[model samples]
Target: MTYGHAHAEHYDLVFRSRGKDWPAESARIAALVRDRAPAAATLLDVGCGTGAHLVTFAKTFAAVAGVEPAEAMREIAADRIGAGQVHPGDMRAFDLGRTFDAVTCLGFAIAYMPDTAALDAAVARMAAHLSPGGVLVVEPWWGPEEFIDGYVGGHLVREDGLVISRVTHSVRRDGATHMRIHFVVADADGIRTFHEDETNTLFTDAQYRAAFERAGLAVTRVHDRDAHPGYLVGVKG
Candidate 1:
């Protein structure tokens, strides 16, 4: 399940809540768009959680919309970019009945797909919504070749007399990486704890490119040596 309904509320608090530089990330995305789609105006971001990208892209794009599957995430995104701009939907089969100059499925959204077939369907859906000459940028999950199994990490954050902590352990199994995360929240309301499980398909670059090509999109995959996991760029012709 995505976000577990309750996980969404605590997600920002535990993960991006502590000094996360959203502006810098948005700026980086903007720069990428400037290079690939300097003239692109209308953009659609699938799985746009919390609206940081939408708000920043609004500075450059004339019309922007976001598609998020989780209601809680959509509510927060609506608050950030207005309710009209954030739609309730998923990447696999969401169609707004209109096209966009740029379509993106970022923030490891593609990783959530159960398998490469689902990933292909999601990419095709994103490609279907792109206008001619439109740009498509997808931030993928860790390729099986690069993923380190049995990895573990944790974080802690304190705010408004409330403390939130999270610990995650990842294990690779049968072409998928299973991430088990546990969260603890302490405040005047009392102490509470919960855990969430996320499974990401270990899709390779070749698989992603094949999907894009099947959708009739010219593909280019680029990986950052130190920064991002990598992005699969496609252009609709």
Candidate 2:
């Protein structure tokens, strides 16, 4: 979520090059919500980066809205889903003055929380935005046991008369993953590079469950074969 302007501008392009299927992922989320709340008509996506999922959610539900903190990313999302649909707000404390039938925090946005305290606040806030019998789905970052230290990855894509390359190296430090990402983009304007140092907390499964339970939600964990890490589904009764 703390992405730079350059990073935000090309986020979708880079992810698409890395084979992220937004449509399919959005479909699965919609299915999960409908399964729990058959009459689900509204949805609110927290940390909705660039409105990729919101675009699909708008088609699936009668009403869909999103909350994003990053200005650069939020601007792009607003353009895609209309300015009124995407709001500027933080995940831990955002009030839209209304409730929805389904609330989702996807794309491992929870990992951005610095600690369990923030995680608890964020979950509680999302749950508070849900109506009776509403469902809350949260995709989590890799658990402590799943993170591999000193991991390296790279991707290169050539399209639209531009050549883009991205590389990343990650290490576990102080119960979190510190990722050093570098991007090189070349076009008629010449080549330019951008660097990002991002940290994602490695919260345990128990911590996730405890947060959901503390929010007064009946919670369950699920693994989507196509998505890494997995998701925690909670129902507000």
Candidate 3:
């Protein structure tokens, strides 16, 4: 789903206020890439939202770019990076006509794929853009067993001159997590509310492994903590 204009406008502020560690996450990803390809110099971020990771990645990689499909989100990302650096594309079918030393699909963006076929297609396309011996890192959504049905979560943030409240409820339906998020924003201008509904596909670990293996990449799952589903690291060649 395309993020609304207001949601995109406040995306960074809300997440930052919520204490999402963008720099640390980018550092971890860069370290993961260097572990496999010591000389990795270029990187591509698929589904890069607001280019928060890109800001830090730019400091580590000599060249960095991003692919985002949502126009609202893409515009914000482009503004953060550069208009020439952020391209308009989707994960399942985007061809930049160049390969990078590292490719990343984070924030559980892979879960946006509706089915296994799409997942395979997405992985294959990402792998196709990897240079020989390059690394692909994907942070996946919760697996079927880990997802809690009818879960409710909320966050409130007051930053600068704005107050933002976000509430979310999720349910597992037909092997997918259906979530409805409501955001309330109040500023000097006025108070407004927005709703975002998203469905994330629930793929098993075996399914993710198969997608990576079928793409001709050696893959491993790295679960860093107990609360979150971990990353899938794949290497080309």
Candidate 4:
């Protein structure tokens, strides 16, 4: 399947399957960004899945907007945050013809870009939407080396007494990581199965820094938190 269609379908399943963890995680990431950003009046959230981070930031910032490529995800986000706030567009090509004090792309959204060229293009696109001295926060995917072979992680969700179990596995090879996720949901309607497959390049720290510099942004700091893999913040000169 094409990336767009696959992403849209995957996003629907993910949100339905993992809605519980989103709010707290998004809030924490927002706090981190707010600490580094100026008293900004506005913020833009790229890949703002389900408006989790975007809505949270809107509560504190003067204005908050989001760009999400998946229509299903955008619909869910708009329902929570209002229709005017979220736009359906790709992270690499969205243009609002305006700038913001802070730009954020969390949840390892950068990994979705395919290659260094696409990653660079996305960073440059984001940079163009940042005001002078603004901050661009990027959360990249973990390198393939970090994945443990033959290991698995899974979660069980019980909402309104309906249970769903989602299991994930990571397989690494050829300088890439392939993640396969399986979901089994049990409801009044009976059992249902959903499967998703995603791939991310095993990019190194140096490669990320190079991309940031090439986009004319200076890497100010790299933070590694125990809770999350962490992020790199770049400042527009």
RMSD of each: 1.7, 0.8, 1.1, 3.2
Candidate 2 worst ten-residue window by lDDT:
222-231
Q: For model 3, how does the per-residue alpha-carbon lDDT over 1-237 read when each residue is reduced to its tens digit?
A: 678888889888888777788898899889889999999999999999889999999999999999999889899888888999999897999999999999999988999999999999999999999999999999998899989999999999987888999999999998999999999999999999989999999999999999999999999988776316778999999
lDDT of 3: 0.93
- What is the Cα-based lDDT of residue 110 in candidate 2? 85
Candidate 1 lDDT tens digits, 139-167: 88888889999999888889889888888
Pairs clashing within candidate 1: none
Minimum summed lDDT over a 10-residue window in model 3 is located at 221-230
Better of 1 and 3 by TM-score: 3
Please give the distance, in angstroms, between residue 217's alpha carbon in candidate 2 and its true position after superposition: 0.5
- Poorly placed runs, candidate 1 (over 4 Å): 17-20
TM-score of each: 0.93, 0.98, 0.98, 0.86
> Candidate 4: what lDDT?
0.76
Q: What is candidate 3's TM-score against the reference?
A: 0.98
Candidate 3 regions with alpha-carbon error over 4 angstroms:
none
lDDT over C-alpha atoms for residue 173 of model 2? 95
Two-way lDDT contest, 2 vs 3, winner: 2
Q: In model 2, state the lDDT of residue 51.
A: 96
Choose 2 or 3, whichever is better by TM-score: 2
lDDT of 4 at 14: 48
Residue-level lDDT tens digits of model 2 in 1-237? 477789998899999989998999999989988999999999999999999999999999999999999899999999999999999999999999999999999888889999999999999999999999999999999989999999999999899898989999999999999999999999999999989998999999999999999999999988878987767999999
